[model samples]
Structures are given as C-alpha cells and as structure tokens.
Target chain A: MYRISDQQVDFILADIKKHGIRIESLQQNLLDHICIIIEQNLEQHDDFEKFYREIIKTFYKEELKEIEEEAIFLVKSKGPFLLLSRLQFFLLLFITFIGPYITYDLVWFFNEGHGSVLPVEVWSGTMVFATFPLLVLLVLYFTPEKLDPLIPRKSKILLGIRPFIKIIPPTEKYASYQQ
Target chain B: MIYSSELIKGTLKTIVLKLLTDNKKMYGYEITQKVKELTLDRIQITEGALYPTLHALEAEGLVTIKTEFIGKRVRKYYSLSRAGKTKAKEKLNELSNFMETMISLLDIKPKTI
Candidate 1:
C-alpha cells in the first residue's frame, strides 16, 4: 500500500479542477488512482521521484491540451441546447440583423407617397440604428458580469477567450492549509 | 536496448491493462515499479508518462478509482472496469500477433548478403 501526502492529493485535485472537470465524487477516486500507482512503483524498488515523474509525464503530454479541447467541443456539440448563453448570443444577432429591416419597411410603408427613399439612404439609416444596440449588447456579453471567486483572474481571462483553453487555477494551496 | 523502446511503446497499453486485469487494483507509482521490476528495469516508465495515461484511461472509463486514508494522507487505487477487461484482452491479442510477426521477421537471415 502506498501513502499519498495530503499535499499531493490536494495538488492533483486542484489540477483536475483547474481543467474544468467537475466531479465531487471523483476526488477520492483520483487519490486512489495516485496511491495505487505509487504503491506499485515502490514494490519494484523505484525511487519516489522517478516513479512520480513517469506517471505525470505520461498523463500530461502536449497532446492532452488538444484532447481536452476536443472533449469540450464534443460536450458542447452534444448538448447544444443547454448553452443558454450561446442561445442568447444568437438571439441578439437576430435582433441586430433583422431589427432595422423591419423598421425600414415600416418607415417606407408610412412615408410611401412623400418621395422615394433611395436604397442607399435606407441602408445608411438602418446601419446607424443597428450599430448602437449591437455594440451595447456585445459590451454586455463580453463584460465579466459574474464573479466566481474560485476562479483565478488569469484563468478567467483565458477561459473567456475560448473554451479550448481550459486552464484551472491551483486551488490546492488554499485547500490544504484550510484542512 | 536496440528495439526496447519500440517494443515498449507498442505494448504499453496492453501491458498496463493486463497488469490491471490481474492485480485487480493499482496506483500510478505501483504500476511503474511493477513494470520496472517485471522487466528488471529494462523498460522503465517515467511518472510523467504513466500518470497521464492513467488519467486518460480513467477519462475513457477503462479504469475506476477508489481512495483509502492512511495516516492523514489519501492513496488512490485504480482497478479496471469490465469494459477495460474486454479491452485488455483484445489489445493483448493484437499485441501477441504483432510481436509474433516481428519476431519471425527478425529471425530471418539474408542469404549471402
């Protein structure tokens, strides 16, 4: 049987969480995985550090980032409807794109006999009306509206850019000291 | 040493899955050490390499983890799932065939250069 230090356990948990894996039950599961690895290595008389490094090297390969990104994409694709924020984005886009067209049609109907409104004039006016609301909606969307204290600031920025960058902040330091 | 790395790389997953199949449960370090001892240090797997594979296997649902407490520390143990066992058997069979082919090819001697 191999014994894992609480510190190491905390580190692994933090690393897993950092990658956006949310499984409360898996905490102990991960610990068990590490302990078994360590114990088996010790049985063979390998030094602790060498054994530890080998395990880490295999798991944290450069391709892991790509694999994670693909996983996230798979999840997002499978449950497209669950992404309310993305739905909101499309809603906003629809309103921005078609809102002015409707307004222009209404204006044309009301002012039909006064004079012909040139296509260029209608387009210019529609663009002017659409730009401001679109900008406002975009600003609102991009703003850090929600504050999650558990997330690190750097990680938050990275996450905001793309789901591909699943950087999880190290929370073990705090968790270990607390325990 | 000549063909050891290639052999290890080709058979790594089968070796790991087979060990898990037989041992019932293991942890990261234990797997590496077991491989080293079993091969007499001829095929050493670094922790950096092993942990990632373990994690990947867990991700793939091939293994499940169980935790135990030992004096204020927690040790993680991994065991193969049912699916993992099936996978192990298939992979081992494939590896066996590949190895046989390679051995036969290597045994062949060119006539008169």
Candidate 2:
C-alpha cells in the first residue's frame, strides 16, 4: 500500500483550491477523498501528478469548478423549490401576472353594481399583462435547444429560493455518470 | 446486471440515508464503497453527485459532521442528525411508495433472486 506524504497532501490540497474549490469544508472533503484514492491505487513510485490528472478528470465533464458550484447550488436550493414542467412554468407565470386581475373582476362583478358584466380594465389588463408571458412562452417553447439553452427541450424549471430560477435537465442527465 | 445511473439517481438520497441508519456513522468514500459492496457492484455513486448532496445534507441539518485530522488532512464523518433520522424514514417510505407505483404502472415483474 502506498502512503501519502505530508508534502504531497499539501500539494493536493493546494491543487484542489487552485481548481476552484473555495469552501474550506468542501475542500477538505475533496482533499481526503483524493488522497484516499491516490494512496489506495497508486504504487509508491507512480507519478502522482499524472495519476491525479486522470482521476480528477473523471469527477467532472468540463471543469472542476463545477463541484463547488453544484454544492452551492444544492445548499441554496434546499429550502423551498418547485420543479415544474415547461407548461407548468408557463402556467405559473400566467397565474402570477394575470390571476389577480381576474380575481378582482370576479369580486367586482359579484358585489352589486357590476352585475355579470366584467370590468373593462379586466379585459384590458389581461391582454396587456398576458402578451409578454405569452410571447415568452412561445419563444421558449418554439426555439431550438441552442436558442433557448436556459430552458432546454424536455427540461424542468426549478423555482427556488436563492438562484430564483434554474433549468434542470431530465433525471437521466443527473444519472449519466457511472463508474 | 448493473442498474443505470438514471435508475439510481432518484434513490441515491434514500440509499445514502438508509445506509447511515444501518451504520452508526460513515464518511463519503466509505458510503460509496459500502453501496458498491452491498449492491454487488451494480450501483456506483459518483463523487460528483455524492459530495454536493452530502454538503447539502449537512447544510440542511440532516447530517451532523465529526471531523478528525489524520496525517495532513481533515476527514469528516457524517452521522444522521435528529432531523436526518426522521427524514431517512420519510424518504425510505416515499421511495417505497414510488417503487410500488412504478412497478404497477409499468407492469414490471420482480425477478426472484
């Protein structure tokens, strides 16, 4: 079994930080994980740097920074989040912008003077407020993947506390990694 | 046969939580190894997914961390917090229901081991 030296441990820790892990706790988590893999797999004389490069590459598709980003994302999104389909996201938007006016119109129509006829502003408000979301929905729904990369095809929108909104790919995307 | 990662993704949290319940405490790497061993190498939890989820669990107070210094590094051992114990049961029950629903919905027959 290979033993990791203090110098090598320091080197790995620094490298983890350099690669974009800013959170001290996360850095330590990754540091211990990397060291264990190295000591368990490598022979005493194996090139540590070369082996590290290969091992680290397996952790992410693009950049190592992604781990830190993902950690922050998960923590921030933990409180309250709604994962909605595209159609549902649009519906939520529609309700947020237009639901108030319809409620007001219904309340006014039932009160006394208005009778069954809805207020003129209700129709106007609906049209004015609805157009933007409608156009947004159309653009988001009709555009190609590249054009609407923020909300890709078959993706869900995560309405969360911190990032506010994020596009989540299908569950298959999360499960794509296997060792 | 190795199950697909997609099949594992939805249940990863539950699996991790369940493992914690079964064991007194565990670290990140030990959890991965235990999962592989218990599943007979059918399921592999990637570090990329595991660390973030662990951090989130810690942040949510679902897991309590105990750190120890070994050689030149800090190793954090995670055990279920009070909330985590409750959450583990809740998650397990939820996953059990989901699995049953899928079994019925897809008309999948369970293979006898």
Candidate 3:
C-alpha cells in the first residue's frame, strides 16, 4: 500500500542498471519487481533507503548476470530449435537436394552426348562430397541445445571448407562450355 | 514453514501453471506476491528462480508473453498457450496423484486389533 514517488522509482531503476542487467526485458521485469517490493515496504513506513538497500543486497551482480545469461540463452536456443522442428528446415533440406538434382538434369538434357562436361557420376560424387557435409553442418547449426557444445568447433571446420567448396565450378559454367 | 529448494524446484512450474490457469494472466511480481499470499508467507518464490522459469516456459511454447508499458517501464504478462493449457492440466493431475500416493505411503493407519 506504500506508494513510491517517481523519483524514487528512477533511483531504484538506476540501481538495477548499475548491477549490470543489460537486457531490456530483464531490466524492465526487475525494475517492476523491485518497485513492487519497495512499495510494499512503504506500507509499513519502513525507511525507503534502508529497505531498498536490504532488497538490493539480496541480488548480487553475478545473480543478475545469471538471469540475463539464462534469458539470452533460452532465446538463442529457442529460435533455432523452433525453426528446425517446423516445415522450414525440412523445406531447406528438400531444396538442398532437389536444387542440385534439377540443375544436373537440365545440364544433362542440354549436353547429351556432347562430352563437353564432366561425367554425371563424377559430378554427383563431387556434389555429395563437397556439399553434403556443408548441408549436414547447416542442419547441426539449427539443431537445439543438446548439440550446442559442438557448434563452435564445427563452425571452424566449416569455415575451412569454404574455399575448397567454392573452387568447384558452377553448373552454369559447365552448361555454357557446351554452348 | 519455508520449503526446501528441492521441493520448490520440483513444484514451481506446476504451481505457476495452475495459478495461470485460474487467473488467466499475471505479471512477474504479481505471480510472486500471489503465491506468497496464498501460502500465508510459508512459501516465497525468489525472483531469481521465477524469471528463469517463466522464460523457460515461454521458450517451450507453454506460455505466451505480452508486453505493455506502465508509465515508462515495460511489464510482461504471461498466459498459457494452447499447448500450455493442455500441459497444465496434465501436470496438475500428475502432481495431485503423486501427492496422494505419497500420503498413502507415509500415513500410518492404526489397526484396531
């Protein structure tokens, strides 16, 4: 029942910021919660400064950091899991497979018996070797928290593969050579 | 009497979900205060525990959050999602059955020989 003045609320908010809660949503939630507690103390005519100080003492900076860390972690983990579980991830997988197959078919149709391009077996082997690992890496990236520990090292390996993969000739280059 | 961390940890989500099922929606501080008041100060949920639980529930698609500004500060209100409502029912039933089972196992009925 003890109502706090706006200036007092501002001071409380500044105190929370000083504790290093950088996330906006978390800062807001903590501010409101602290304000509620301060006002509750006011109903008993508790000294504002003393009561506020006592309340702040309960939350060490590390604890506030943990809240922010957990929230940020959950948000980061949720997006990829949610996306991958839905049809979008599968659609991307489908596109990853069909896209290359369609291009190969188109190239074969255009270059039948011309012998101007790499054999289909060779091209297929190259696609599987060069691209399938990249695709698996993409799938791992979107997977949930269970695989989080593997992501950092896996990403470094993928970065190493980038130049080698890019060295493969574009399908368009192969098609144009026949023309 | 204050509850142990183990007890609170196991039951917190069920308590929060049941509270939401009854109240429709509640903000962070309100949920804490409501729980404290209902338990007559026997149980007080610290903010550290509450916020993380709420965020986890939100992440799991069991709760939806809506934000609105109160003066200059933003307040987030939480309510159950469709899946959340179903989960709440299932969880509450499970907790209730567990409690009854515990009581039956622990209670000593006197035998009138």
Native-vs-model 2 lDDT?
Answer: 0.82
Off by over 4 Å in 1: A1-179, B1-6, B108-113
Best-fitting candidate, scored by TM-score:
2
Please tell me which model should have the higher DockQ, number 1 or number 2: 2
lDDT of model 3 at residue A73? 43
Candidate 3 lDDT over B2-110, as tens digits, reads 9875578678889999999999889999998899899998888878767867877887899998988776667899999999999999999999999888779999574
lDDT per residue as tens, model 1, B1-113: 42354445546667889999989898766787798888777788754345545665676788888876665446678899988999999999998897779778899544672
Span of 10 residues, lowest total lDDT, candidate 1 chain B? B1-10
Task: Give one digit per residue, the lDDT tens place, for model 2 in A53-153.
Answer: 89989887777878877777667665566777887987787687667867776677678464466657777886787777777767766784756566777
Interface RMSD of every candidate?
Answer: 8.0, 2.0, 8.8
State the DockQ of every prediction: 0.15, 0.56, 0.18
Docking quality level of the chain pair in candidate 3: incorrect
Weakest 10 consecutive residues of candidate 1 chain A by summed lDDT: A170-179
Spell out the clash pairs found in candidate 3: none
Best-fitting candidate, measured by DockQ? Answer: 2
Candidate 3 residue lDDT tens string, A49-143: 88888887775434456666545444443321221222344455466765666576567757776656667685786577647756765676567
What shift in Å separates residue A84 of candidate 2 from its native position after superposition? 6.9
On a 0 to 100 scale, what is the lDDT of residue A51 in model 3? 84
